[model samples]
Target: MTQPHHDGPRTSVRPRPAGDPAATAALTLGVEEEFLLLDPTTGESMPVADRVREALSGTAREQSRQEFRHSMVEMVTPVSPDLAALREHLVALRRAAARAADAVGARLVAVGATPVREAHRTVPDEPRYHDMSRRFGPVAHDPAVCGCHVHVGVPDRELAVQVCNHLRPWLPVVQALTTNSPLHDGRDTGHASWRSMQLERWPSIGPTPHFDSAADYDATVRDLIATGIMLDAAMVYWYARPSASYPTVEVRVGDVCPTVDDTVLVAGLVRALVATAVDEVRAGRPAPRIRDCLVAAAHWRAAHDGVDGDLVDLRTGRPRPAWDLVDDLLAALVPALRRHGDLDLVRREADRLRRDGTGATRQRRIMAGTGGDVRAVLDHLAAQTIAG
Candidate 1:
């Protein structure tokens, strides 16, 4: 894609207002899930996206794209009116995607980070991924990571940028709670979500600053391009950004959870969080700093302990037990949860995770029983994908 002219003035282009009830109700939900292709029986990385794509061509309803192409594939569900519909679309699409993979002597596995990724690996060359690897060099070539992204539609571009900026502080919280990648190259990386550290190697990855308007956001994006650090706004790989082609802020921090229920709950939480931020901004309420800092600390804890460490209370900088922080986050998000009509689903999944722990916990347990056999772990991951 050709770069845009860089002559626009950099000025704040704030949205109409944040909390207008009219604006709040105008939001919509979408999801972008990444999957790994692997040998069905041996559970090793497999470049089967082409075959999967060929099988799904003219068959699947979701918009499937060759994401890092070959070893990884992504499917985007159409924007749904509510969380329930979003969940339904994703569930159906995942099932079909899995089936397509199965037909090609491969299986689809949903993961935050693949257990045995070699950063230097590349799939069969495709123009997009090829250009990406050429542009990013090592960061794009790294084959060990994957993630789950949620896109909530904003009524206007300015609102979308505001929502993305306000949502930054909490980005780390979502990262920590959804931290799932525990193994890399068949061994523990000692980080809950190794993917976060892996992505940090890219040029524009991490927490983003709040922008006053779409023009300000656009100007900031232009700066990244002029510096030659990224090819375009779409490549600005920050944890969140106003999607270049869509009227939404894509939340890119969460790890791919293991169960269908957890996926739904996480989706609900993301939608609610954005809605809440949009509302608070409209009300002229100061954005919450605790939410921002806690999110960063949460990423640190989750990376180190994988749901086993203490996360700081965003409000006081005091460390709180991980479980307690999870509880508090859920409680604070209740209003947003209710608005999405996903309060019950979020509660159910949160309760399950609280009692059983996140998917990483389960993967660890299975590995222990099988003597650190990653193939066994892959079995669990593959089974979980179908269950979704």
Candidate 2:
């Protein structure tokens, strides 16, 4: 990727006047969700992603790509200007992928990790993947994990990098809202998002540091590359980063959600966060200055308990109920959501999520109801994956 001029993101792009959402076309959003191909009976990952990929047609085939493991595949939505359109696109794509999986005798499960252990660890035949496996060894096992990535368009690369700075603290709260992986390797991990824990095995995966400017961000990336820890810029697994290819900021903190509604809620909140941050940047406001360890603690707490337990609120450095932090996040983003015409959608879905609880809580409930049968949880996930 060619480096662009770094004059700061706010040099030419000022805060928008309070106007219709349609007037601000640059805020278009996209989502990418990774899924696992599982054996319907055993719930272990099936190494038939190539067959499923071949079966996909139309939009699903066009927008989808293979993940590192042969048991995994990723489907991305097209750039959507509104939450409703994003929902429609996600529904269609997921349905198409599910159909393809069925045709190949595999069940596509929208989950962060398989309930049962996958012994195969089938790495793809691609050269880059082979190199990764050779270099990283056991760390390559982490790619078996799935995640939901949200991409929000910005005016330029500079703006996207700066937005990531403002987004540092909020990533943990958002991660808690979408926690889905509770059972892993046929056992309850006692953590809401086991996938989040799995991801940290990779050297590059963690909280993004606050960058003073795009130049500062670029310098850090170069230094990491020089250390030979990461293969390239694309390998930096920060919670959020400026897109390597698109003029957008991609937030990769949340685990892949169970249903379309959960995914949509994540996208709406993330975009609103980015919009609010952009406004502050244009207004010459400073980003939050909590210590790095506190931000990491917040992330760890979110992964451990999700919505079922307390989170360390960064403001006071004290633990608060997870729900309270979620509500505070919503309150902070209301103006941005309203400006983007997504206020009602976000609010409604948030209430529903609160009532239904995080995916981890639901999984635990099912585990108890079924007398500790892990297969039952997989069955529930299979049905929810294509329920749209």
Candidate 3:
């Protein structure tokens, strides 16, 4: 693999206000979501991402980019302090992507993995992705999987590392709530998020262990890269980690939600969680000491059953109803949510998801209604992807 170019160190010269800590360290948020492009009539995966990119050229070039597979594309939102504004930006971007797909005789579905498509044969014409394909073999070419990554600003690297440790246990809960991929290769995988399982094949992809300090985190990452297990910091696919390029901690647990409201809900919860963790560190509280093995088990359970069955509650390390665990997480983060003025919105959106079920459940229902027709599942996902 060719070494990536480095632009040298960036030194921030901005002045900081003297008085209020919260005012100085306000948490901003952003989201990156991936989608699969498919043939509109056949619901089969389409390698038309280049065409979609061409359609979005000059208008949303900064907002959208091609992914590793030609069947996939990713959109990223600019950082915003307001959740509503973030949702609006995401909606506009999704609409733009949908229009671009339409112009190319394709459709965009925002599920975690394409339901009917087998492994994507065509890799994007990029050096890094080509290296990944050559190194990882078939795992890199599997049915394109998508995810929703939330970045919450923590400017301070030490705080970001501490927040990553604090956020580790709760990741499974978030994953359960955002399970959007239950089918793979035209059949039910029985796992709520087969995408999670697929990603776990990579060495660096899962719950990260607790790091005592920022230095510790950096050393661990450097060691991993040195071993040839991964190529660079970008390949450290932990469920939550400090962003390599941005001054934020990125949470990469959740599946790409189909609905705008659901995506907003996940982003809001992620920001609140980061804010809450920052407060805990500021207050001199020690990070939670959950064992990494238990955390991995919780992640596995969430990926397997989603919110439909049981989850290993981190508080007790015992199996509990998934919704109960979700409620517990909300209650735990209430103070942060209230502080950010996102309490009401998060509550309402979460309640709606619980009432209607998550994307995985909806996909199953749609498939059942259409006598297990994968096209119906694709149609439902595409409709929900554009609905808000």
Query: lDDT values of the candidates?
Result: 0.73, 0.86, 0.85
TM-scores for all predictions: 0.89, 0.94, 0.93
Q: Which stretches of candidate 2 lie over 4 Å from their true place?
A: 1-26
- Candidate 2 per-residue C-alpha lDDT over 174-284 given as tens digits, one digit per residue, 9 for 90 to 100: 999989998887889999999988887887888887776777787879988897888888897889999887788999999899999999999999999999888776665
Off by over 4 Å in 3: 1-20, 23-25
Q: Which residue pairs clash in candidate 2?
A: none
RMSD of 1: 4.3
Order of the predicted models by TM-score, top scorer first: 2, 3, 1
lDDT agreement of model 2 with the native: 0.86
C-alpha positional error of residue 91 in candidate 2 after TM-score superposition, expressed in Å:
0.6
lDDT (Cα, 0-100) at 364 in candidate 2 = 90
